[model samples]
Target: MEFETKYITADIKLSEFKGNTFKTEVMFEHHILVWFISGETKIIQADGTYIFNAGDIFLIPRNQLATVINYPKDGLPHKAVAMHLTKQRLKDFYSRHKPAGRLQPLQKVYSFPKRPLLQSCLASLIPYFDLGKNLPAEIASIKIEEAISILRSIDKDVDGLLANFDEPGKINLTEFMERHFMFNMTLDRFGYLTGRSLATFRRDFKKAFNSTPQKWLTEKRLELAHYQIAEKKQKPVEVYIEAGFENLSHFSYAFKNHFGYSPNTLIGRQR
Candidate 1:
């Protein structure tokens, strides 16, 4: 699980831990997909404790406090794969399509973390722990996607990993938008990047960011354009094109909306 893939907003890392304690406390600095490969642990959350063992697959949601209390075994070592997920990654995941019945609308079983089916998969991955250390980007990406698919199919609680594909993601969404605002910055493209539906993407992104994705995009373009003009002294048309606006008229309109002045006026003020 130690690899970097295009699909991964954060790199995957594998860790082998050796400690004997009933109670272990630590704050979650990032969202994590925890796959337990060996040994056992008592998962302690605000809700309660769940006994987790070899083959246990679970998720630790970001910003939620939790702890791990190890279940001791004399012969075996404790090992796990923890993939750190950035907010952008979550946003990217939800940018495309919503899967039907992917998530549980109602909460149940406070003792267990979301996505219990990962135990078997994590068990299956025991042999590949070392392969993760030298994973090819394409292979790593495929494995992660497959892992999510399995997680969706087997999970009974939490949101289906695939069910709400249209949900706004954390990392790749902003990166994608910020990267491709000019030529064809369409919602459809955004959805495709994360395997989602355009309609679903629009709904979730608007809620998460508090503006239509397109509107927000236009503003982004305008802001970038102004920065180039004010900071670099680029011409209005040049800045517009450089910022990815295809049409001068459209760029002017968006630039005005964002800055409360014509693009020309701003450039003039600078000159």
Candidate 2:
């Protein structure tokens, strides 16, 4: 509500930018849950490419290493609303569920009434930025909630809206795996990020990549470790840490199972 930087559940915030196409990168480790109100964003990564057009909302989770190329880089011209959170947000979302309306499990997007509804939502948010500039924290939180209500009113699928709460993609699991391979990220986290129930996120993630997120994530980290020892300059222990592993033995075992060789052998062969 008041844009508290402290631990929050359903806080909403806005961002504005105008620019032309320029090579960009993502560094912040928090999952970037966003709705692109205008323009296009292109990302080139180790796997392939991702093109997100206007009217499309997507989730770019943590620890990804992709380059962003935004259209109209010079003029800038971009508007967005983002809700940032860590693992707890995802867990809390599903632990408490609703079955009454289409809003049962709030879609990572809440309910958007297609294109026109989204346009209006974006328009309504403009005043918050204006009001937020002047009001003190106490008053600002109330005003922001008012804005959130306005957003909900326009949503066609409001049946499943989470109480005082919050808030899609295709592509493949590898893309998700590369970006969000940490243990802290649970299935409920995926649902909260994508705006679905834990059940649905598990099903969808499995269908898209033909594997569960957990299994895929393990393979992804091990695969990346192989690449580093075989090609990149990172040492085995360093790559283990970089890939989010807490135990060197765990990394070693997974690496051997994945590539049929241990860290020591891989490093020895590289020499």
Candidate 3:
């Protein structure tokens, strides 16, 4: 049996997913504070990997790429509460209460495991999950504010991440694309993350790769998938999504078209 429940306001949510392991690649637009109630999560970023267990609290900074995999553990579903610290809310907060302390370099993810204060703040929302959309908006806002306050009190350098509101700067397109080719995102999103307009991204891409973005992305994804299937003996179903294809059928079609044979052919040969 499988089920999922979510009670979500604009800023806060309590979510539970049961049965199959779930995975996704995303770039968050707002900072996320998460409290795990059950199960486990593995988050892979460019910098490193992090695993969260039940009762663990963690903060994910915005504008960074990550692949998240959640699994059911000990017969409990992957369940957690997540709160969004939106840019506007943080601006207002910092304006009212000026942030002070030494600025630290940004880290990919912060783990605050078993903190009583944060646990209490997040646990208070459990009853509200049953309320669903009927949850009052002000209540959500207050809860987010409360979380921010608790973070500041517990971790002094958190202000460095929460108070700074800066958009992504221009980056080396080649390096960024090479590192993030496996994430399926829109061209506009890719362009924005690399600090370019769509037109400019296209132009720069053409100049650098002598190919269009779509063609280049497809070729790279397929190349990676080919390596996994042929050399690493991985199945198409296992590598499709991670290789950036949206679906198995699409991945199979593209693989056959590019390699002049089905992916299964390679798997069979390896076996």
Candidate 4:
């Protein structure tokens, strides 16, 4: 099934998916405020997994890698409204109101479920969605500002997330890769997140692992797939995508090549 999105503004949108389920991996460039109207969303990050049901609201910080799965609930399509809080916009908001104390960033998805204040704030915009072309850009901007304000008021520690704008610093490469290799991101994205240039990432990676990034990633992913199928008793179809392979065909071919047997063969032996 195809995903559909209707933009109330350039930054605010209503997204709908009418299907069994839709899953996608994404690295958000802007902080996202999502209000689930009628659906369930499962978000898997490097550190943890989160589930949000209908009437749930959450904040996803920018530059975080996550796999999101949206599922329809109660005979309705999975529907939600997402407001993107851009860097420039947040910078503008935080300039006038200073954030006290040193900024300490945390990788977390904040949830504010059943909060009357937040629910009211988000529900107020529902009417304007039907306005379509008639809705003014200033109105969307005003709503965004209101959201930022409400977020700070509701959670004082949110300033640490919204106010601070720092790029990814140099981190331990081996640790980063081992944690995030399941994500199918470009080498460039991996390099950027690890605070290295493409050339430097390549050089540093070779020294650390003694294998090229592509080769290492493939081997590591297949190992994970093998464990999941053989030990965890998961099917090849279920394990492939999470193992970092783009498609089942590729995953099956690679599984056979790497372990000298298809994943199904391993499953049959266990059975």
Candidate 5:
């Protein structure tokens, strides 16, 4: 079955799926707090992989790409509650309660250690989910505030991460490319994320990688796909998407061209 999701509030959503395991690439537009209520979720980021089981709560920073896998456990559907924190809401909060100073950027994902306060905060939203009621905007905003407050109480550094609402700054082109090649986004987006104009991004990319951005990204993704299929024993269909290819045919064509063999050849050999 295809993946399905439901929105409980403008900012909060409930996602559920059953009878099939699936993988998808997600690019977060807002800061997200996820509560895994059942089954399991594996989130693979540039830095590492994170596995969330039932009752696990984690925060995902905005403007990042990740490969998410959802599968059933104990003959039940996979389920999770996701809260999206919008930039405008965060800005309003920051204006009223300004943090002392900027803190270093947060990690790709912050897995909060189990705490009663955090659990209670999540529990408070259960009724709305059960009733399928849309939370009033004001009430939802307060919930976000409460969640942020809890995070701050647990880790003061969270205040800094939430206070600074700015676009990504100019960063090392080489380093950025190395980390983000698996994201299937346009060159224009890459340019903006790296804090460079399209023309400047192309020039700097050529200087840093000795090739055009498209060429380098294609090669990088195919290389990673090969590794996942040949060494990690993953299926071509799954690896293709994770490696940033938009479709299987495109990934297969590029893989065969690069390696002088079909991707299925590797998968067939593995089986």
Candidate 6:
């Protein structure tokens, strides 16, 4: 199985997949508008599972971890067009349009129902993917603008979600950690996302969870790995990665220390 992406512009990309089934992690740095053409895409996040089929268009919020599964349909390769709305692009648009007020926190993801205008806009951009990196940046920018306009027409919430760009504010530590522990990122990243300095994050973490961030994360991940291995019948290697361990050796060491047996031993007993 292989996945490839062609850039139409710095921020916009066209992705193609030649895979029957595969799992990968995604840390979304920018808000994404996905136009599915010929595949079924399943995204599993902390909140829920979302599936996108052919001719489906959806918006994914930035700053979250997601596990994505792509499957081809009808014996064909998977293909999709993804438009990434980077922070700079959003800031530029906000400066130009100057919307009146700030936006409330929007939904994590938005799936648009069939809309002719949105579909037409996506169709017009399909040909440009063939042009590959040679596609002029100016032309791609125009298409991005057009897409934003169409989305605004379809949903008033679009403008609010896209325009009011700001760094994440302080959030409750427990809630944030519970939703994000599966991500294999540094503590500093977690601190930034929670809008706390490293010192404050550590202090708040201890107060909230009664443990250091590292200790809490390790225990939580191991617990999840145990569930996947013992209950879901998944391999330890796969569970280790998905549960946010750095590698098999560390996971194995920790799993045995925590559970008094190796993961393979558990798998053997299950069999």
Tens digits of per-residue lDDT for model 6, 1-271: 3889887776777788896666677767889998988888888777877988999999988877677778898877788888898888878877787554337647567899698888888788878777644568788788888888787777776777887567789999899899879777778788988999999999999999999888899899999999999889999976786787767899999999999999999999987
TM-score for predicted model 5 compared with the true structure: 0.86
In model 6, the runs with Cα more than 4 Å from the true position are 19-24, 71-74, 95-102, 227-242, 245-254, 262-271
lDDT of 1 by residue, 1-271 (tens): 3222222224466655565443444445445677766678765443555677765666665433345556445566666676654445444554653454635333222223445455554444445554545556676565555555565455544344323223334445555455555433356656755446888777767666788887777777677788888888888865555465666898888778777899789767875
Candidate 2 has what TM-score?
0.39
Q: Which runs in model 2 stand beyond 4 Å of their true positions?
A: 1-178, 182-184
lDDT for each residue of candidate 3 in 236-268, tens digit (9 for 90 to 100)? 998887788878999999999998999988888
Q: Which ten residues in a row have the lowest lDDT in candidate 1?
A: 1-10
RMSD after CA superposition, every candidate: 17.0, 11.9, 2.8, 1.7, 2.8, 3.4
Q: Rate the local accuracy (lDDT) of all candidates.
A: 0.57, 0.55, 0.87, 0.88, 0.83, 0.83
Clash pairs (backbone) in predicted model 6: none
Instruction: Rank the models by TM-score, top first.
Output: 4, 5, 3, 6, 1, 2
Q: How does candidate 2 score on lDDT? A: 0.55
Comparing 2 with 4 on lDDT, the higher-scoring candidate is 4
Lowest lDDT sum, 10 consecutive residues, model 6, at: 98-107
For candidate 2, lDDT tens digit of each residue in 1-271? 2122211124456644554433444433445445676566665444556776567655454444555556643343555566453445434543654323364433232323355644554455446555545435555454444433444455434424333233333345445554656433456655655556788778878777788777877887787777877888678866675564656898888888887878899788767
Worst 10 residues of 2 by lDDT: 1-10
For candidate 4, the lDDT comes to 0.88
TM-scores of all models? 0.44, 0.39, 0.85, 0.93, 0.86, 0.80
Scored by TM-score, the top model is: 4
Candidate 5 stretches greater than 4 Å from native: 1-4, 98-102, 130-133, 229-238, 247-249, 264-271
Evaluated at residue 164, the lDDT of candidate 1 is 27
